[model samples]
Target: MYEFCPHCGLKYEVEPGYFYGAMFVSYAISGGVALVLGFILFYLAGDPGGWVYVAVIAPAMVLIAPVNFRFSRVLWLHYVAGIKYQPEL
Candidate 1:
């Protein structure tokens, strides 16, 4: 993670432990993914065995982790930290 934005020199971490909230955001994202996947598996796939879910959803979560991590922090920064986008800046 960057300590500061390269383009604008704004600190990524606005305060001590500011990113801690991002963890919850990430978890929520993960849970939402899992819930949607589970719903699909249950309805579309006829609720395959438990191991099928483990095999599928586990890797899916892992695969999305990088995107989830970044997006969650960005959301936390914009939505929670009230950092507005300034394209002119």
Candidate 2:
């Protein structure tokens, strides 16, 4: 990731290791996706076999990992680090 926001020139990391907390945010995002997908598999798909669940969920998770990783870090910056949005910037 860039050390600063290209548009506004704001520093990306407040301090060293700041993004370590984003790991928890990423975990939460993964858990939420798993829970929702599990429900869909259980109810809509009529309780597919364990292997089916693994096959479908694993790929979906992998597909969303990039988005989830970026979002999680942004979330950590906005909420945990109290970085406020400044549209004027």
Candidate 3:
């Protein structure tokens, strides 16, 4: 599975453990985006109850779960694949 690069089409083998980093990256991106959105809502609403923040942001985060999964896989492929393509003359 870790045998292809998505960006450049380069083929090289990589250890399975290498993908763990991509998972971290994906979680960080998703969580950070959700947190920021939560903060924005809090500010706009004059810092309402804590539940307000959770209620609004939790759904947004759930909505993004699928997208995050897909993004993580693509990122992993890019890192592992290390494959590059060249244009034909």
Candidate 4:
């Protein structure tokens, strides 16, 4: 990623470990996905085996990781870092 925002020239790396907080956001998103997916699988699949959950959920999480990663960072940037979009920039 760029060290600073190309639009407004805002420094994205505010500190040595600024993005660490994004991990929590990612965790929350992933947890929610797993929980909801679990419910769907449990009901739709008629209470499948534990291995079935692992087989499906693991790959789903892996497939969504990249999107979840960027989403989490964007969320953290807006909510936690207070970064806002500026069309004028």
Q: For this target, which candidate reaches the highest TM-score against the unseen true structure?
A: 1
- lDDT at 6, model 2: 86
TM-score of each: 0.95, 0.93, 0.66, 0.93
The alpha-carbon lDDT assigned to residue 38 of candidate 4 equals 98
Question: In each prediction, how many residue pairs overlap at the backbone (N, C-alpha, C within less than 3 A)?
Answer: 0, 0, 5, 0
lDDT string, candidate 2, 1-89, tens digits? 88998888889898999999999999999989988999999999999999999998899999999999999999999998888988986
Q: Report the error of model 2 at residue 18, Å.
A: 0.5
Could you give candidate 4's per-residue lDDT for residues 1-89 as a string of tens digits?
78987767889878889899999999999999999899999999998999999998999999999999999988988998898887886
Per-residue lDDT of model 1, residues 5-82, tens digit only: 988899999889999999999999999999999999999999999999999899999999999999999999999989
Q: After superposing candidate 2, which stretches have Cα over 4 Å from the reference?
A: none
For model 3, state the Cα shift of residue 35 in Å: 2.1
Residue runs of model 1 more than 4 Å from their true location after superposition: none
Clashing pairs in 3: 4-81, 5-81, 8-83, 10-83, 10-84
Instruction: Give the better candidate number (1 or 3) by TM-score.
Output: 1
